[model samples]
Target: MFTLTTLVLGLLTATGISSAQSGADGTGGIMAGLITPHAYVQKRVSSYDRTGANADAIHIAAGATATILDESGPGIITHIWFTIASPEDLHLKKLVLRMYWDDESSPSVEAPIGDFFGLGLGQYFLYESAPLSVAPDKALNAFFQMPFRKKARITVTNQGQEDVDSFYYNIDYRAYSQPLPSDTLYFHAEYRQATPAKGWTTDWKSNGDPLVNDKKNLNGDGNYVWMEATGRGHFVGVTMSVLQNQDGWWGEGDDMFFVDGEKTPSINGTGTEDYFLGAWDFGSHPFSYASFGAPVKGEELAGSRSSVYRFHLDSPIPFTRSFKATIEHGHANARSDNMFSVAYWYQTEPHAAFPPLPSVEERIPRIYPVGGPGNAGKNP
Candidate 1:
């Protein structure tokens, strides 16, 4: 039911008219009366290498390439650009915009396209930009309203640190049939810890070792514990240690981290009370320990009495993957008897200042039971 000479020969064969073109309302030659000769072209089908020596950072590097532009169905991706001609100062941090239909382990949807002003994942969608200009080429344009599902994949990741060598992109799928409704959000994160060692007393030179100075228990020696899995993706950093026997506190102790198992309420005014990211209170007075960053808000650091806490989530604890954490005690008289010698090392990889080895092997056997009664007669 289209006749204006078949909608001006389907808009002159979708803007490619040429058959001795003739348009002046006489409508005798508008690509031969009603355009429909297979239109849709704006291509650049391949490009790859997201880093040197087999990707995944080995020298602070970055790389990316993917393009398939509309193969069918209502389309108008307009623009999805990139250009960071490296010159230094490219700490761009997280930029993942994935839309892979039926591949890469069944992905039908995903989103996070060049988010710099709107944080992304950990929550803020877009509102933070200042370092994308290098001499004359550092661009980013977004207007992706997509809907051509049979096949599509666009992945761009460079979680900030500046060193993004090169980039330039374009994707404008055109067509029209009415179909647009998909914004993408699938989220993921995984790292676990805990096994067969509860509350206290793992037999450290036994004599009912709950700390009469079994080196302050928990296999002491500058003791350090960790655990933090927040809003889902952006905190990227952590590595833990402790497997039994060291007893004799003096290198520092207490570095707890258990952010999303609920129940972190204990911060009562001090230097860092947001779930205590760092602590080494050797009975205070001149012995210290503290380090913080990220939205970890206060209180809940109670454990000590022959302590025994072990945890490890190395990196990728920001923007969810999957989480759970436990183990807290820092002197209060030393005898909380906590014990979890192993389990807690998750990964998605991206936080290496040094220390890398533990990417999941599965271990679980510590059900909370050592030096019971919650500190039976506490005294420091």
Candidate 2:
């Protein structure tokens, strides 16, 4: 069950094809040739007025769910755009996004709308990436290609107590006359959070002190997980938001990937910033790029929020059996900080059931009285 991402990556590895030349095959970028006719019919499901009026937005009452799209397919979703207006705070986290493929009873994708769009801390900030983006003035967009054979359904549930004043969207897709390739994999995104990651011990002088750095974490024990999946597919990327509960740097931890149930991580990185394609604590300023970035840089102090993202578009990590992506909170998992993240990938159907989403009160970011400069050795 190779995902389309894996197929492309395999081709690249086998043929010695450069990433920039990927579009030379007439399937990729602007070089894909808009002048050339396409095989599928372009379609869109949007929040538009049925009677052709100007009021194109819809209001979703509290605890209500809005089915944004339901269509029979041999179709592939290409793009999604949304702009929301709500009075409630943290509306992004309160709105849950779910999508199903091929009439599956379980959702293939489940996450907070904000996290899915790379706004993991329930706050809006402009950033762009190959698959997801948050544009000026609170516009969220996604360009992930999601293919389905029999059906595709997308919905948003309002889990808050206040109604969403205005919800607008445009979902662009391609309706194919023939069936999709059998090897095409479905898209998925799952959210996970640790309001405050528990550390082994708070008895430390500083981040680099021997008390904190001497411990070993060769197996990623007690690491905060980005995602875990039991399937055959490839991992695409992750967006993570961190709320500092301590007074030092929160990214001394390394990233480890245990693929196919290996006793130890087969793929490991030097540090969190290194895995995110940054060095020296992301320097003094924030930066954003097409594939990897830290858009919201936070101070090295308590009660600060930072969001970072990285997409393995050029090289999606493939797995045959299982994949568990995790990262330490600090060196050897010794930092107590709040973390929220969403992992994206393409996989075969019947994915492992996701863990239950945290309660609304738990999802909101806040300073937990934990191991830190202000509340050292205090319980959360």
Candidate 3:
């Protein structure tokens, strides 16, 4: 299995850039590539006004789309930056971001703009990670290296009822004269949600009761799927935002990964918090890191909200035929909270078609009344 370290070190070869031109010492960070560069032309396509006017933002009407980038390339996108001003409620969740690689009709990347930037609740609080971040004052940034052979296109659609007053963006990419290496893979992200996961029963006394904990879920039958892909690639990470419908701790669930379409998961984790590199309900506090974080830690009560993320940059799980990344809603699939997530990966195209995104109303985060600690013994 190739790790992100291997991928980063192999970037020169993957992008058809010779080692002599890169001058990398294998000791410095990604900055080592900056020491020597002989080949590609670095370019940027931003929302700057073509007329060279002072106003450099685009206005997108409700139900309309804005083309952010359209370029012919044997190139790789290095960075993407965006800042927006809007009036619609939950505007971030209503804005859909899509990317097409090699002129494919279907997008390889389709996710809510906020979710794609690790703010799945449509509300942003500053958080930073290796490949994605929400910086100071609502600046959304991404550093994923997206390589395309023939063409690359990116668009954002306003699904809200109100028009987007201002949309600002800048996409930086490298234009290569030479073709990318054959092993280079395209990046992809897909969004999915379960307004409220269904459990066998919600009348349990506690999370550890035999009625809940003893029910085996070895196959991940009712697991909330983060990503399911049919291709050759590895899952990079996930951003998950949760709205609590039921009360009490909402993370006794375990993380499970079924690689290459196996009947059972080969990778199983201890618990939800543990999978994100945290423990004990994230110590009931917020934390952010380069590879994993719980940026929004919620109270153990109904209507609470939490957002967490994790990137498998250290050891990406590789799959040959398929990959299914899932996690139990609660131990033995026993919680009914609202779950929304974006799964990130790199794979060979033409990748599997993504399911249609939920309607704007459906995507909005809200708590649903379900029976748990809040009303454990009541009918639900």
Candidate 4:
């Protein structure tokens, strides 16, 4: 037992703590990359001018694909940054980001450029988190390390009608001389949306009748699924966009996670806002944290939209056989609202194919009342 414990401790010291310290982040303190030198070459692929001239940003024409990177790698993609200037607010949703690992025909990471940067509604806002962030001037940044043993291909598709006049980007990676670990997994980000989620058919707002609309949810049936995955891996986190079609707070929902095909969810949360690490309807304030944040807080009223995200960098939910993650539309599933999300995780190969991406017109963030257009434009 003593020998086993010593060996395990040594392994953890070299792999867990030391590995992070010696990553692309080349600075900090005693934990520095230079301390334990390894055979890895840091490289960058960007929209830098090929000539010594000044054409910095690439102009991706409408309905065209831009291959930002196609490289052979026993390497890890360390960082990614992008910024854009366009007239369409929906361009964020229309422009797609796709990345395939080990030369896979299909992309392991497929999502809207904005959603991948933690801006769910296809809108830009300055916010910061551990893994993703958006700085001033709509500069987006992502720090998810994606490892590939063979080859990696990354592309951005302009599905919009108008050209992306200026699309600036930079991708940094580290080429490793040694092979990746046996447990190293592929990074995947799949986008899902219920442009308008189904909820109670009628508006139950009677003056005298008090309806709590509360019920217990077991078995995880009919829940708004974020993503369901098979094999062994860990859940990183998700970015969510919520658009309110009714007049009032639209966040009474709870989060549920089913691990390994279990009938009951081993993990559950109190409410939507609570699961995002905020309370009292997020207090209608923008806040950023290392783990979770609500960078864009819309007014708690009809026609409002909010973007929120949570990253599980420190505490990743592990699953051995399978995992299914879902969240309620509202308390007891009682709200009809627009919802868009992207769930990020790292897992073994043969990932479940993602649901079809909705058409660009469907993703434009529309707000329509559940009951009808009788009381449209009016909050209450």
Each prediction's TM-score against the native?
0.21, 0.93, 0.92, 0.89
Per-residue lDDT of model 4, residues 1-380, tens digit only: 32322322222221233234334344532244344544568889999888978888899999999999998978888789998988766899999999999978878988888888877787778887767778888889887778888998999999999999989889998786667776777888988888678765345542111342545566655568888889888888899999887655677778999999988899989888898999988995889876688888888666888888876655678898998889987766666778989998888987877778788888788786566222264222
Q: Model 2: runs farther than 4 Å from truth?
A: 1-30
Task: Give the per-residue lDDT digits (tens) of candidate 3, residues 2-79.
Answer: 343343335523222212223233434454445554367879999899998978999999999999899998888978
Worst 10 residues of 3 by lDDT: 12-21
The regions of model 3 sitting more than 4 angstroms off are 1-9, 12-27, 375-380
The C-alpha lDDT values of all candidates are: 0.30, 0.85, 0.85, 0.77
Quality of model 3 by C-alpha lDDT: 0.85
Q: What lDDT, from 0 to 1, does candidate 1 have? A: 0.30
Q: Residue 104: error of model 1 in Å?
A: 5.3
**How would you encode candidate 2's per-residue C-alpha lDDT over 103-222 as one tens digit per residue?**
998898899999999999899999877677888999998877788889999999999989998999999987877777777788889999997898887777577889888898999999
Candidates ranked, most accurate by TM-score first? 2, 3, 4, 1
Runs off by more than 4 Å, candidate 1: 1-188, 193-235, 238-369, 372-380
Model 2 C-alpha RMSD vs. true structure (Å) is 3.8
At residue 28, what lDDT does model 2 achieve? 49
Clashing pairs in 3: none
RMSD of each: 22.2, 3.8, 4.4, 4.8
lDDT for each residue of candidate 1 in 1-380, tens digit (9 for 90 to 100)? 64333332233221222212213234433335445443444443222345543332122244433332324443434344554444433133233334443233432222223222122112211111111111123445432233342344555554444545554455555454433223222222222222212233333332234463344333222222333333333332221212221233311223333344423322121211123243442223211121111221111222321211211112223334433333333231232322222122222322112112122122211113333333233222
